[model samples]
Target: MKSNSHFSNSPFGKQKANKDKANSLKNLLPPLPLFILQPLLNHIVSSVAKKHPELFNRLGDSANKVFLIDPSDLPLFLILQPNPLNPTLKAYNQNEIIEHDTYICGTFATLMQMIDAQSDSDALFFNREIRVSGDSEAMVALRNALDDMEGSLAKDVAKSFGVLSKPVLLAMQKFSKNSGKENG
Candidate 1:
């Protein structure tokens, strides 16, 4: 007669193994954190602003208050104060007292990624990725400003971010080929 290993027939061991497999699967998912992304976005926005001071100037004039609300924090808006005097963008939550010039609301993840990727920010509005609930005229003004900025910066930023990459298509093709081999 031989002694059984500790985990060989233990219910707890089976549960632990299942848990470990689930954790491994979770680890395989994309790991982009919003906190890590914010600063990168702030940098990109600031850089774009610096490159084209005219746009911010126009935005400052057109927009009385600007809010950057994260969709995850629904019903609570994160107001972005664009200082005309100092010309800097500051963020504030609903609880935090601050002045806003205009509200540009979206999911922080989507907004930051769009900005960083230099894709059409207006796409968010049209595609309903970002929703604007107030001040249609102001939104239109902001859209025009973004259009101008996009004309100047989108190409360069898209190239730098590799937004035009066909990696997803390539990956799908590769996956289909592998699956065909398995079936054959």
Candidate 2:
């Protein structure tokens, strides 16, 4: 019998295999320390708030409301409660769905792209690439806030890494470009 295993061992196949392995590794990671992550999250949000106060300003009463940002492709979720006084981030295991006023669900790439302002929020929502539930007001406010922001959150986020930021960002962009290519 001619071996059909050759196709399974091709470059595209290997890429898929690597992606599967990465997903598995991510699944195996232990629950991270919320306290350690909170400060970092706060800093990012604070930076954004400083740059565009209007976003948070629009939040009004909903500023204190907890919003769940769930990435459908990952085994984790993030809870964000925007506070003019103190913004914080709380991460949870996939199964630990907590009560929240608003929930924004999307693939990891879609969420990242949305946060980065790399794509149109309305288009993504209309295309069904993103799903929202619960508080529509809070969702609109948050989306508008992010959308109205002038700079790239992805760039700001990378800069948070200090010296390693450039290299990391480059690698990520290259990886994204490579992975996005169609395999013939």
* Candidate 1 lDDT, 1-184, residue by residue in tens: 1112432344323233234324543335443344554564465456666666666656755444454443332223343444444433433223333333333545444554454445577676788766554344555666666666544343343333455425533543454445334323
Kindly list the per-residue Cα lDDT of model 2 for residues 29-88, writing each as its tens digit.
666566676676677777776666777787787787777786655556787888878776
Look at candidate 1 and give me any clashing residue pairs: 64-101, 65-100, 65-101, 65-102, 66-101, 66-102, 66-103, 67-102, 67-103
TM-score (C-alpha, index-matched) for candidate 2: 0.70
Estimate the TM-score for candidate 1. Answer: 0.43
Candidate 1, superposed: residue stretches over 4 Å from native:
1-46, 71-78, 93-101, 113-123, 150-184
- Give the clashing pairs for model 2: none
All models, RMSD in angstroms: 17.8, 12.8
lDDT of 2: 0.67
lDDT score of residue 170 within candidate 1: 52
